[model samples]
Target: MQLQLQTLPKVLSVLVMEDRIDAASAIQFKERLRDLTQEGDQRVVLDLARVQFLDSSGLGAIVAVKKLLGPDRVLELSGLTPTVERVFRLTRMDTIFTIHLTHEAALSDVTGA
Candidate 1:
């Protein structure tokens, strides 16, 4: 559950440094994200380039984070590996979130660049 948070003008980019998000780390993942995002109103971009695997629990945790963010702020995803992208697409979570091809793209979208 190693994650790095970078604060931008109107976005908080969380780079998921772990190679996998599974049942074992789901709870910790959710808690850490909650702690990191609690004080911000900025759009959240979860950079998952390094994440190669995501299980049901991990998916659930991500959805939970989106719900925690509420409707005002958005939870976007970027740099999904093919395997990770398949999970989101299969679960139809892709429609539930804005998926960017890269981390820079997510930031640019928020910054109007």
Candidate 2:
């Protein structure tokens, strides 16, 4: 997966550009997220606009990232494609993390805009 990391004033956003996030790519994605979060950002947002498919491994990777972020950190999601959104909703992960309609919205929230 191609993971791009961007930083706002208070949030670090990761845009994943790939059709699928499966077992093969989940580890690398998780590492990227970990590295991004380790940069001392308070908020993290994963942008899944280009991801057309997500499996259990992908979901697990996200959950792992959330855990790594811990209670004090904010981990949000944005730009979820329909299929990936369905998985999140089905798994009730939508309630577990903040889900925004767009990256701009997520950034606005973190940046207090």
Best by TM-score: 1
Please give the CA lDDT of all the candidate structures.
0.91, 0.83
**Whole-model lDDT for model 2 versus the true structure?**
0.83
Q: Residue 3 deviation, candidate 1, in Å?
A: 0.7
For candidate 2, lDDT tens digit of each residue in 1-113?
57887777777878887889889888987887787688684588788888999999999999999999888887888999899999999999988888889987887774422
Off by over 4 Å in 1: 111-113
Q: Could you tell me the lDDT of residue 84 within candidate 1?
A: 94
The segments of candidate 2 whose C-alpha lies over 4 angstroms from its true place after superposition are: 110-113
At residue 62, give the lDDT of candidate 2.
92
TM per candidate: 0.95, 0.90
The candidate that achieves the highest lDDT relative to the unseen native structure: 1
